[model samples]
Target chain A: MPAPMPDISRQYQRREQLTMLALAFPALLMILLLVVLPVGWLAWQSIWHDGFTLENYRRILAEDIYWRSFALTFEISLTVTVLAVLLGYPIAYAASIVSRGWSIVILALVVLPFWTSVLVRAYAWLALLQRTGVINQLLRQLGLIDAPLALVHNTFGTVVATLHILLPFMVLPLYATMQKIPRDLLQAGASLGAGPVLTFWQIFLPLSLPGVLAGCTLVFVLSLGFYITPELLGGGRTVMVSMLVSRNVELYDQWGAASAVGVVLLLAVAAIFFVVSRFVPLDRVLGQR
Target chain B: MVRIVAQPSATQRGRPLDKGGESVDIRSASKHYDAVRALDNVSLNVAPREFVSLLGPSGSGKTTLLGILGGFIPPSSGSIHFGDRDVTLLPPHKRDIGVVFQNYALFPHMSVGENVAFPLRARQLPKADWPDKVRAALAMVGLAGYESRGISQLSGGQRQRVALARAMIFEPRLILMDEPLSALDKQLREAMQIELRELHKRIGATIIYVTHDQREALTMSDRVAILKDGKLVQIDKPQRLHDHPADSFVASFIGEASLLPVRRADACSVVLGPAILRSTRPVPDGDELMLAVHSEKLLIDDGAGDAARNRLTGKVTDVVYQGESLRVFLQLADGTSLSLRQPSHYEAARRIPPLGGELTVTLHPEDTIVVPKARP
Candidate 1:
């Protein structure tokens, strides 16, 4: 008969659990200190003003300007997500199919802009999209238009700048997923009588949906709270939730209203994530087993 | 055992189309990647419903030939004909061929039924008949009632069956297999080999199989095409290939052979280490000649006055005990090593020759083949 192994296995299990906890302690502590504590404080501030009143919530729900800001935020975020995906899919597919050296070069170019600050990128777009910018100057010199087009300080400027900033977030996930698909599967599909377009639609596109969802979710959530690009490029015309929160804090000194707006944005982003996750697994989007 | 219902051919399902089996003719096919020639100018003809295996070692361009046949790779200078139709420049989707990849590249997101129905959907066949055809194909591969199972849920052998079912569901004229069974275990691989051969017979579809396994080629192929270094060495029936290899490379690649350096005495005879060996076939013209003898053809001399033509006496070097047979290694007087295989149930195994003991073996003239040495 074999010796009893329950005690030994139980002891080993306890040690394994302890080791996992020990290894995870640093990250957990950092998240608690940096993220959870601040969010919890903001949530508390949103409701509790000397006696835990619902005044900030009621005021946000009743205000028309705040509602407009929330609507504009979602509209711009959705538009930016769509544009990023449209532009990023082809770039990601090209990177996935090219040779290793070429793929590295493409990926390097995609990531190169990340070295510069987002504010700097936004400022550069401002220079290019302004009335007297290089694009307007070129159009005028070419005799294309008599008047300068209103490219910046509006929804157009916000979307173009935001898409430029969020494109890599969309492309990197797509490339990761597309690169994992075996080349043989496409060949097999073709041999089974699928043309290039049909094969792409049936095999390649479906397999890449996870990456699309991942990139869209990341871009959308990040765009929800986006402030720098819209603020610098929109020229105070395109008002979003983040800009509203800053106005409430900086100009009006309304800490309660600002905290409430921050909390609402967090919940809205979480809700969008929950809905997307219901359709496709979040781990698949992240390319994790 | 589930009884499979008889079904019409892929083209005969509510449509009057050409039958699936079409003869293939590959003429002077070649592929070059800049300086490296993956496939040299080579020509081959495959009969309708014939099972041909392209057998070679790695980097021998067998897979390249298969790819060229499937239209996956365009040859540098060659034309492919499918029943007199020049399909040289045709795309893979327009070729109407089925391909089974080495990794069994089934769509992971699709279920078994959907995978089997992919080709039909690609052809824009009627959706109403898809379920019945999918079921019939699954039943043909002995995997009925598994339509809804996810790809990841099935084992390796089951996935292979799914791939086969998917390939044949459309009743393609030709199917290309690229080392499909190399991923299976030994016993399973052997079983699948027989099943695949039977499947080929039942479907009557022309098959072009590429594998590096000599045993598999001999077991399942109607004819084995041996290749080396982007060149076709020989193409013949398995038994003929084993008996009369065109050169030393074909001899060594087809089976276990020991090529002994010999001098050609004449057209039908050669001088070995110490004895003159006569071959049943005439020797081809070459500077260097070698006597290629299969290990199984060497028999121990029972001292009954046998009339075999060639005899060799050597010292026993070693004996390896296989499960069903014993492999005896002997070194000739001139230091040429020869291996002989004897069944374990044979009388020779009762008393294995000890190391350093004199062992005399006889070989019939018909069993010995003389071929030219490989080029350096």
Candidate 2:
């Protein structure tokens, strides 16, 4: 007896499914081993310290130090995101419009810091931003100020360093988006009786919103878990969630407390991702479409 | 959500529906980029409500002239005057002229209504008057009730209509179009040429249209300006441009005509290989002359031995069966080859000579066009 057409088609579909699974198996296995297993262990440790009690979470909520760290983390991330947008947008715009050779040079300068160690760059900022540093000395030589300003070892230094480190993240996506905007649209806007300023406001700005959104989301999320720059520049004064998690583990050897803090920070980042994804698709935020 | 606004008469508002166009006087304008002369010493005048087309091949500086007039490109020298105002250095927004781009350039981010309302917003018109104005503009383009549609959802023709509606929504006196129909298909482009003529008549705006298609220029414009190598070659009415071309280049470019080298025989005649052809127009002053043979003007000789018509003998090389007409290719005794078109009816088909057979043709004195060879 010959097999039916539907049966043969079903067999072909089964083979296609098996092929797709085989192609995806390596990456899936790596994720299962590296990310899922560690996160599961952390969650289990956070709750099952003493017969699965919720004591670690309770202590985290009742503690004032943990609350301050969480609040400070959000405050700094917001400030950095806003500053990155203001400072990075013009650089990206300039790069987009310049000649191709100059545009590559500007982009190369932005990416130059990535070749150096993050710790080295953070320490370099410390040297330049300290009291009576290069900026203060120049100001004094110019007779601008009588006394040196407090430029380092505080939230100011932390923000300055963090913005410098994260600016490339904001600029690259903005340049990508701005370069794709057709020059004809700008000319059309002008010929339709719009001045340069009005044309930029109505046409250019709206078309670049995708880049702005993508850059802000990336910088903000990365700022949440930032450790080295804040640690070196914050001078142990500006505490963040990551700092708290490390302190609980290294100083006190409280594995359950550290795991609980880790789990909470992870949930916070996930919640933010969820909210932003509701507004813009994930692929678009990653500058895919 | 789509909002179907209430319709109102154009006169109900204070806007002038009967406004005539503005006269444009471009005087000796020239544009240079680096060392290349994009436009050189080209001066053109356009009367109010007159439709003039700038026709040329690619890189012929037709677009550069339009750009200078539209204020997108600054002229390296000379000035432009609109009516009594000299607007040589004015910016595009302050000049108050509309422009329709080739690709339409409609805002992909805005709805169809918003795209049309953009000019009004830029001019700072009243907020309450937008809905009625947008509706009227859309209706003019035969796209009524499409205000809520997204630009991505519309077809190419619909997008073109939307672009037209947006450009003319504010009713500028001078409108500039840069090859706007080049993106459309052949059938759609022909249909639009007529529609555009009717629209120009109703609006009464002085439209400076740029195109590279010679047929389109002859079909639509009251006066067609031909450009060559950044120079104004010829500017005349379409019929005159077709009937009496300025030179051999203009003769061959404006329509289907073959040029054959000839010598001057008299004050009003020229001599081909063995025949003397008379022209009603004056012979141009040049060292060399060529005769332009319009394919449609040539008739199959009936062997009646007409005296007024110039006759020539040739051998039929090939015949092509076009849908409505038959093309007969022939080779003259002096090695000059030319083709003529005849109707594809049964009688005409039977009259056509066989391939490689001798055939006699005649051209009337009025149809004989002899022009000077253009100086390179």
Candidate 3:
């Protein structure tokens, strides 16, 4: 008598599912067009040249200079990440525990360097670290040294500049994680007869591991593809994978070799991410949880 | 001038306490935050193995006093003695007191066994003895097999047991609990209160518990201290506190009492709503006084020959039907409101007067408590 009901509830559920998918369609389309397309094209260029050939990849593996560049790139990234973490952890901890106004001021200072261009920052480091620069002049006047130290135009210059740029990346996530930790846990540890150092080790440090992992992953991944700082500060003395790739394209006009280097670096980054995600959940490493 | 009824010593219970129990004495302790005084000059003494509760409303300095005793917050002035040592400047870890925080504060990263063993590790106890101690402590809280479980996987009640186990694992001479049951549901809180009381009796550790719930303080403590603003208003055994509160504020806070303003008739009597009420306790000297009549102490008078000395005639204003009891509200001739609680099955409840119907009630002289109005 009521026209057989028409399964109204089931029909409503179907409409809701359609609405959810419709809402997500734009993001999916953007990912497909922007990210998947470019990456697929890059892979295609690396493997296919005058029909299908693996010669570009073979050249990379056979060359000692390319291998040296890869090694130098990894060494610089690892050193910069370690230094950033060692220096950033205390700054983040101090910011998290201070008064609200002071915390804001500290965070602002950490983010201040990000406003300057990478090229500008690299050049600024050159001025401070060059021979007869401020540091060398001060040391010579103070009689701490007789000759100027070779501070710039090497791996040391590249690392010092990169560390300055990436330190905020490390400190921000650490501060977010440390601020979320409840103060009661520390008090509980103290009440259980733990001194300050023990409390920090057992309670505070373990809780903040997720932030450390996140900061390291971000700095390492970003450093793997870094070009501007290393190119300017390296002064042709310290070569990295990105510099080699760029030289191949500019000097030899070898698009295949450049594409091959890009594919190799991408695969290396993916492998490292897989290994890290296996040990710690990717969401936790990103501080998403 | 109210007579102070001396409470029987806790030792009179005829049970010897465990060896680790220690007495605590806080002498004139005070704390100031910038200009605001969080804790005024307050002194209290707790016997070894005796359980005392600091009971108050929010911002009443109960937590501040607990912090001072725990050595987490230094007092502005005064000293604290555990047994005989003055621990005025000692840090919290050196004080060797176990604290169960309000949130339980179990480490989310560690397993339940590791959390319980944390105190043992801090004290650097023998490694060989840790397993047994951890298991024993977990078993004490009825969480015998939960040692390996993750803290996040447990429910609120289970987490609370884990916290209790961790606090007691060290067997510290003193243990402090800050509203430990406030987060649990009502039924679970009541069950934990009973279990905690049994645990205290078995362990014989002096416990300084802080809570805002009056019923919890009454059910769990040997003595309950009431605080108002930054001062201790009154401290006494639960029964004595309920029976003879020292001021109107204490009377209203500890139990359900309708404080009717009264004029002191003499040294031992007061006039309440056209009735002269005599009290066995002397009248307190103050500009303002109130007759603190407990709701449960009022009885319906049927003009019996053995009537109580104090009587009042009133009209039934409202009747609140609780499952087990009925709250009968009355408006006296002087327009003061009084509440009386009677069992649902009582004879008077069966024939409860209709709204606005006349009724008469009696109050026993011993139950007629008079207290000075709290100083504003």
Return whichever of 2 and 3 wins on TM-score: 3
Worst 10 residues of 1 chain B by lDDT: B10-19
**lDDT for each residue of candidate 3 in A1-289, tens digit (9 for 90 to 100):** 5567678899899999999999999999999999999889988988898899999999999999989999999999999999999999999999998999999999999999999998899989988988968888999999999999888889999999999999999999999999999999999999999999999999999999989988998888888888999988888988999988899899999888898999999999889888878888987567467
lDDT of 2 by residue, A201-284 (tens): 999999988899889988998999999999999999999888988898889998899999999999998998898789788776
TM-score of each: 0.93, 0.89, 0.93
**With candidate 3 superimposed using the best TM-score fit, by how many Å does residue A170's alpha carbon deviate from the native?**
0.5
| Candidate 1 CAPRI-style tier | high
Residues B266-344, candidate 3, lDDT per residue (tens digit)? 9989988778998888888876998898999988886774554688889999999998989999999889999998988
Better of 1 and 2 by TM-score: 1
Q: What is candidate 1's TM-score against the reference? A: 0.93
Model 3, stretches more than 4 Å misplaced?
A: A1-13, B1-17
Alpha carbon lDDT of each predicted model: 0.90, 0.89, 0.90
- By summed lDDT, which 10 consecutive residues of candidate 2 chain A come out lowest? A280-289
Q: Please tell me which predicted candidate would have the highest DockQ against the true structure.
A: 3
Candidate 3, pairs of clashing residues: none
